[model samples]
Target: MTRLWNDPQEFVDEMVEGFVLANQGYVRRVRGGVTRSTASPEPEVSLVIGGGSGHYPAFAGLVGPGLAHGAAMGNLFASPSSTQVESVVRASDRGRGVLLSYGNYAGDVLNFTAAQDAVRADGIDCRTVLVTDDIFSAAPDSRATRRGIAGDLTVFKTAGAAAAAAYDLDDVERVAILTNDRTRSMGVAFTGCTLPGADEPLFSVPEGRMAIGLGIHGEPGIDETDIPSADGLAELFVEHLLADAEIPEGVDPATARVVPILNGLGSVKTEELFVVFRSLVKRLGERGVTLVDPQVGEFCTSFDMAGASLTLLWLDDELERLWTAPADTPAFRRGVVPTGAGVSASDAPSAAAAAAITDLDAEGQRDDAGADVPDSSAESRQTATRIAGLLRLVSDTVSENAAEWGRLDSVAGDGDHGIGMQRGATAALEAAESAERAGAGARTLLTRAAAAWADRAGGTSGALWGVILRSLASELSDETVPSAGDIVVGAVRGRDSVMSVGGAAVGDKTMIDALVPFTEALDAAVSGGASLADAWQDAADAAERGAESTTGLVARLGRAKTHGDRAAGSPDPGAVSFAALARAVANTLKNDTEEES
Candidate 1:
């Protein structure tokens, strides 16, 4: 399915307009959507670059005082025309000359070469340097012809420094080429990116498998392999770059140094990136390479692909100095600003000082050492067990109804919601049981259970469940006993928190339909001084009625949005699940209270 866009051309044009507006003070938009550095208007040399959109902070994003002077922006995954490149060159021209630096691709080379001829004819001196550092892009024998990857950052830094230091255009071109030669990068993608107006992904990878050496524009990779653990993936990526860069095969006992860059493609989390970094450092040390000045984060991305790339730039004194130079841009900033030179290692906090300052137990209460701290009260244990039972029921219900829900989602949604809900419910039940066994408080048990559920089951429903439970736990912070009034207050606060965070309401065809009425009825019954059991029964009945009403309403949000009118006459599964949970809570409360009395 194609994506919905006003028009691809207009979309690209408007985006360029916004980018130029945001960077106007620091950089100026030259002809053809190329941005030129405003700080170095008359540098001894100038660097002109160009590339496709979506790979932000690459060609255009690297334009600044200490990077490329100008960049010709292209359409997403499409090359810019020769004329467009020439226009950018003319706009960035200085008396000294201009250097063209770009990835090694046939289309880019052909276009940039034509632009170079045109610029030379206009009496502006210009030269070109191609970056080919992707080891997977070409055979080892033809590595010089490979496409550039994350190593583009190293190339820009080197060339930018050369230009800023008053090197002529030729000198800057040489520096860029040298950096490209010394750098190498490789990446793997678990999933492909989606280009605007394109329903189908730009490329495809088999589920539970990854494409090694995948191109940013959806091109086929060298091989497909079963997905590895984060640590394993890190080792594979590091091995590829190190081999290509020809880091010495044997470890030197003394004076071995290297710089490692761990980059996220787009959608990977910072936590995952750090995990990869930890593994990479361990492997590098084993190889006798001392990591110096490591840069780890999303320096480059391929839209929202779920993957990462590793780039290694062998650092020398000159390269290291240039890499450490003061440079600031929207996405990257680093410099050698001095700090606290006199601070010694002994002045840092000792291990004993870092120990807990309070004698509070995990539940945030005094430990009272040698005194018998009470286990969870019988009422609290019952409440926790009821929650665990409810979660188990929901998990079973979801598994049984998976086929029906999957059929509904097949038409418009991803068909994973049922599975996601089942997984989350299972996790919640497990957490609740564990917390109860540990004698945790009501609030702590609920919070821990919810966090476990959300972390184990990714997606919208998991997040919403986490919010609801977290809000409920927060409301019960000081209450030792949960009366019907306390339940109503917690439910109301939880409902409000979900609405505020998710921007959904009673008629949004979301779980809010059942949740809103359940909380409202509970509040009303409690305010009228009904018994706790009676109030819970009333709220459960209202929740059931609200959930049933959703059968006639068309879904207007989330994956259901694509169903349009077809979603009508079918109750939202989220609302149904919420109603089921409300009823379960009411029944549990009544039975437990009767037993206690």
Candidate 2:
């Protein structure tokens, strides 16, 4: 369990701050995460790697000379935002290209791909190498679907070393790909991990049982069995990796030179790993495999998960050379490299990059946001005020039901949905209210709210809500108050935007389930000549029905997708929150319209 924190939402930020403060000799704080204290002197390839927090030495600890140039740290167990990645990239970019590497999680893929495109558009070359070494996540033929686990270390290390050795961007990328290909890991857990401020674990293993092939993000494993002895566990890991045929086709299993990583996920102390590693080495030697510099310690970890993983990196000549290269960071280190030999901090960021990093949240939220509000008619001002009221109601409703939402989400997902929604709604309310006080028009108010929601929430829900609000804002013109028809169009647009951005269909057991029905009902009612408030009420009711119907759904998307059966009979937290927000908006509309009348 997490022992200390101010706000759970701020945990990642505070963690990053403290990490930089402690490792000032190795890393410096950037907007996103951290960059090497001593930058590359020449425009050589830069290695940028990251994922969620909790995983210590695997990421930020690997940033330094002859290792990653920077890391983009996201919230705990969440992927960093594209903006965050771009900020880190720009902060660390030299004239040479950048190599982006991370565990192959869905959110990480989406955000990192977007960031890659953004940087390439800016004429800064960017390439990505996704680590997919967890063999049990998918069949051997479909290795692309496998999630990276402790194997993340090998790929990142190889790529960073290649970049440090002054390999071109293409070579750095190639090494990263090769490392991922040659690496495979399998993890087992005796218990599940708890997140900050959460009362329970993300998952649990029955007493005396063990979960096998678990993820580093506290995701439950795919297989289970009775707990095994240290020797038995080592044998289990070796058999799994060997049977998967992950070693290069030409490499013989009997004599392949490999770097074995015996990694403690978390709460599996160093002593336990050493005990396991002893058996692991003996088993490998008996199999006629030669081990080189086998690593034994925490690499990538889940927060306090009582588990460990074994990774085998079958090395080629180049890989073996890079694997042992001298490196230094707060956590990971090897042979020492010359100081002041790489890009220096004096290079810093371009003015544009600096601005993007500094104003990441604030710059995205504005419409005509400056204190200068164009003169608007009383009706427009009233509409803006109503938008503020809607967010206030949403904030209150979400705050009141936050715990229930968390409970429902905990049944299937990471259990942060409720608190995430509350944070976003509250932030949106404050931002919208401020916009209204600034005498902004309807569109400006909603746009401000949308940005604030996304900026504060910091998860899938946050990004989706931002898209929904932005879509709705697009419907309301700055000049006129929104009519029932306009509202209906906005709802439709919001629904479509959610689907487009979220990649979740109505039946995927996400917010889309409720959002689609709500929009349809709103459209139908408005077309039937219903008043705005009445139509909104109808939409809200439809949303509730849709949310309730989700109890029968098996999630096909997001975190719950892996535990579909376990999630049956529970409504998606996102869907339920959407329904609640719809009702709150409807209530606000009714009250405001009645007062005006």
Tens digit of per-residue lDDT, candidate 1, span 269-346: 878989989998888887777777898877767777788888877766777777777665555666632222221243
> What TM-score does model 2 achieve against the real structure?
0.93
Task: Estimate the lDDT of model 2.
Answer: 0.82
Worst 10 residues of 2 by lDDT: 363-372
State the displacement of the C-alpha of residue 76, model 1, in Å, after optimal TM-score superposition.
Answer: 0.5
What is the alpha-carbon lDDT of model 1 when measured against the actual structure? 0.67
User: Of the candidates shown, which would achieve the greatest lDDT relative to the real structure?
Assistant: 2
Off by over 4 Å in 1: 1-5, 244-256, 336-597
Candidate 2, residue 316: lDDT: 84
Local distance difference test scores for all models: 0.67, 0.82
Runs in model 2 lying further than 4 Å from the true structure: 341-346, 358-361, 364-378, 594-597
* Cα RMSD to the true fold for all candidates: 21.9, 2.6
